[model samples]
Target: MSKIGVVLLNMGGPDSLSAVEPFLYNLFSDHDIIEIPRLIQKPVARLIAKLRAEKTKHYYEVMGGKSPQREQTEQQAKALQNVLGENYKVVVAMRYWHPFTEEALRELFTEDISKIVLLPMYPQYSKTTTGSSFNEFERVFKRFPQVPVIRIISYHNHPAYIRAMVENIKEHLQSWESYFFLFTAHSLPVQVIKRGDPYKDQTEETVKLIMEHFPEVSYALGYQSKIGPVKWLEPFTDKLIEELIKSGVKRLALIPVSFVCEHSETLYELDVQYKSLAESLGVESFVRIPTLKDHPSFIEALRQLVISSLQ
Candidate 1:
């Protein structure tokens, strides 16, 4: 029997404080991310990375000098490997950091795999996330044209995925009488949406599906992680939280809808920064639900998706 290889794609975080600057450089250097001319973008990206390195390093330090994204992704990989058994080889391909997508593909080419499946951990489709990684994979896979490949770009509204999210949110909401559901996803530049990127659409759909599962709960969707001066997706999470406080929402639950695993964004930004802000705003019962991170339901979702794709 021909072996099957599965490649999991994600935007990786810096493994150490010292690697933060270079990680940022790589992130901004990608044309799919910044969309600037290569000649001018490289130098500008370098400057931005250097200027932001210290501040970015502080966030990493707060999260214990490294990002748990790689570790969480590894756990997911192992779980999938266990389910798929001996014939399938699972590989993690992070876009911006160690175990990079290109590097991972190069290494996998040496294995006895006959076919490859590209499954990005991102549930929603985004040019900066899934598109960027897919582009890199295609570029590298060109070197080995003999190997067949299949790709699962997005599974945002799959029933099992929605179920996993519902379960996680309910777990955090236990015993809370009245609370506002703050569904947050990483913001993208407004220009990207204008260009017809389906990210905002898909993200909204995912939130909508999850919202449908619990009609009794009041919820609002917002975008987070806005960088630079350009406008991003509307009703930013921080601003929305403030608004919710003014509206007499005391108890709040923040759900990271875009991320499936904990990273700097969730660990530091949401847990630390947002929690502090919620406390300052006098909001009681500020709870941030954990990312999907190796949840059995999520793993089963992956298994089902892969098995269907193979057929």
Candidate 2:
């Protein structure tokens, strides 16, 4: 049997208490992820990273200074390996966190694997997010002649993926009259959109498909997690909530479209902060559908992505 590999891609989190600075530095250093020219990129990255580290450290502190994504990614990888059986080996490569992409790729390369299918943890296709990681993987993989081939799973209007999201949302659906379906995703700077990044558009496509699944529901799209002081995708999540309140909306159903798993942005920002803000604004109820974590349908989606790429 020809040896094949599935290298999972993620925006990694800090592995330990002390690694936070370097981890954030590595993340902010990526021009694809945080594009500022070399003139001030280093100084700017260092300054923001230090500030973010302090604030972000609190979320990690709550989770014991670790992201459950590592454990979850491992579990998902093992399950996928089982589904793929002995035909392929599975591994994870995080962009900034522990079990870095370099480490994962090095290990897989040693397994004599040729050609890899990059199953990014993100469902939707975004140039900055998924594409950045994919590009990096390509750059690194090119160094090894034996590992010349790579594939990226663009994403997720797949039936299995849709089914997984729908099922998860269904479980959390609260009985309310005319709920606002807030499709939330991580926001990118407006400048990037002019460069044709496609993150916002990709997110819109996912929300459209999801709202299609529920024709009876009235929905709205909003962007979240805008870093620094620059314009982002409009109708920000916080502003949208306030707007909805003015429009006499009392109930909302929020979904984090850009994320595949629950993290600080999802748990703290959305679940804790946004949820409270909604309550304060007289929004009757706000329910967030959980991320697809070890869900059977999502597992099948990952397997299908890999197997199809092989074909």
Candidate 3:
């Protein structure tokens, strides 16, 4: 029987402090992430990576000197493979680090694979994330074009995915009425949205679908992980937190709406940095609902998506 290859695409993080600079370089070098003239892109990436290495490394150090994204993604792949049985081979392709799209393609090409499914781990479609990964795959797939491929662009409002999000939020809710829910996603530049990226709209739709489970709960959407000075999707997560506190919102529950796994954004930025900011602002109870990392419902959601794509 011919095996079906399932590739999970994600933006990988440095495995250790030593890999930080190169990882950032790889990230910035991608035109999809940072638009720059092709002739000077590498130089610019190198310079930015060098300047940001120390600060980025410091964040990694606090989180045990590495990122858990690779491991978490691998676990998810394993779960997916088990669910898929022997007829399917599930692999992970990290965009900016090791186990890249090329590596994943090579691995699957070695198998008796008849078809491939490109599944970006991102729920919301963004040029910076899913578009970048798909573009990378296209670039690398040139050498290995034997197998047919199907791509899942986005599942922001897929029923199974929406169920998973609702279930995750329900698992973490304590005082649903008292705690104000803040759904936070990775911020993108306003320019990107202006250029017609569907990320912002899809993220809002995901929030809407998840909120159907709790009509009585008060919730708002915010963006996190803003970089540089460019205007990004707002209100920013940190700013929103402060606003909530000033408005007498004593309790807040932060939801990682766009992320499926815990990474620097969720672990350090949201858990450590934003948590500190909230406490300092005199918020009584601040809770960050965990990402849907291999949650049974989320795994089931992936399984359903993969199965549907194959049909």
Best by lDDT: 3
Ranking by TM-score: 3, 1, 2
Superior by lDDT: candidate 1 or candidate 3:
3
**Over the stretch 1-311, how does candidate 3's per-residue lDDT look in tens digits?**
78999999999999999999999999999999888799999999999999999999999998999999999998999999988899999999999998988999888877889999998899999999999999999999999957789999999999999998988887887767788999999999999999999999999999998888888888999999888877888999899999989999999999999899989999999999999999999999999999998888888999999999988
Evaluate residue 234 in candidate 1 and report its C-alpha lDDT on the 0 to 100 scale: 91
Report the alpha-carbon TM-score of model 1 versus the true structure: 0.97
Supply candidate 1's per-residue lDDT for 227: 94
| Preferred candidate (TM-score higher): 1 or 2 | 1
Task: Give the winner by lDDT: 2 or 3.
Answer: 3
On a 0 to 100 scale, what is the lDDT of residue 114 in model 1? 88
Tell me each candidate's TM-score: 0.97, 0.92, 0.98
Which lDDT tens digits does candidate 1 get at residues 124-220?
9998999999998877777663677888989999998899898888776786447789999999999999999999999999999998877878899
Report the Cα lDDT for candidate 1.
Answer: 0.90
Q: Candidate 1 at 66: error in angstroms? A: 0.6
**What lDDT tens digits, residue by residue, belong to model 2 across residues 50-163?**
988888888778777777777788888888888988868999888878787778888787776767788889887777878888888877776664654566657767777777
